[model samples]
Target: MGEELKVIVFSLAHEQYGVEVEKVRTIERMQPLTRVPKTPAFVKGVINLRGVVVPVIDLRGRFGLPEADYTDNSRIIIVAVKDMEVGMIVDMANDVVDVDSDNIEQPPEIVGGIKAKYLRGLAKLQDDRLLVLLNLEEVLNKSEIVQLEQFGE
Candidate 1:
């Protein structure tokens, strides 16, 4: 069998989540955010990263969870999807975890009313904590994102 997939895990609303490490470009501190009007509530705003203006999405609100106050551990996880570099804000970034394919199970039919389509899988850790593996593309690919672009145009 091939080697296991490595993921960078993070926390949001006290729940553990993860995304493929390969998809993650970097983790940066939360910077000044510029709000975009008429966009989805989950889209916190945009920030310029080294001259690249990237949209920042708040994972807590995106998942329909209560908004969380940013703390010292808050971070923006920069992930590359296709040709776009997006930033996802989370309560705190945990660590990179390696899990065999067998250890990752398909997301259940229901996750607190969240569609399984947004999830890549579910990783069970040795410590008995569950990590909801996120499907980066699906989670961030919303009509509102496109609408925001039109508004700016």
Candidate 2:
């Protein structure tokens, strides 16, 4: 078998999910956000990170899931999509995990109503839990990023 792909897994609602570790820039606690008007409801707002205004998106809302109350575990996952850096909020951030290619299954048609096009794959961990691996590029497409930039302009 080929080398396992290491991923940074997280939790949203009651399900586990992951993204390639290489795509993740950092993980931070939920911070105060500045609301942006006329954007998608999933686009929560923006935050000034070290003088850089990073747009924040609520992953739960994007996936059409019910809004979750922020707890101590809530986090903002900073990821680089193409040349732009964006922040996505999740219910909780889990640890880095390794999964072999053989164990990575194709995403099912129905994943909490998430479109298959947005997913990379589904990873099954040793604990019998499933992690919905995300295709960062697909999840945060160029058009959406461009829209965000337009909003800032």
Lowest summed lDDT over 10 consecutive residues: which window, candidate 1?
144-153
Instruction: Report the CA-based lDDT of candidate 1 relative to the real structure.
Output: 0.83
Give the residue spans of candidate 1 off by over 4 A. 148-153
- Model 2: CA > 4 A from native: 151-153
Instruction: Highest TM-score: give the candidate number.
Output: 2
Clashes of 1: 0
lDDT per residue, candidate 1, 1-153, as tens digits?
436989899988777889999999899998899998877889888888887888888988888888878989999999887667779999999999887777788999767556788898898877888889999878877565575444333
Instruction: Return the lDDT, model 1, position 138.
Output: 86
TM value for model 2: 0.94
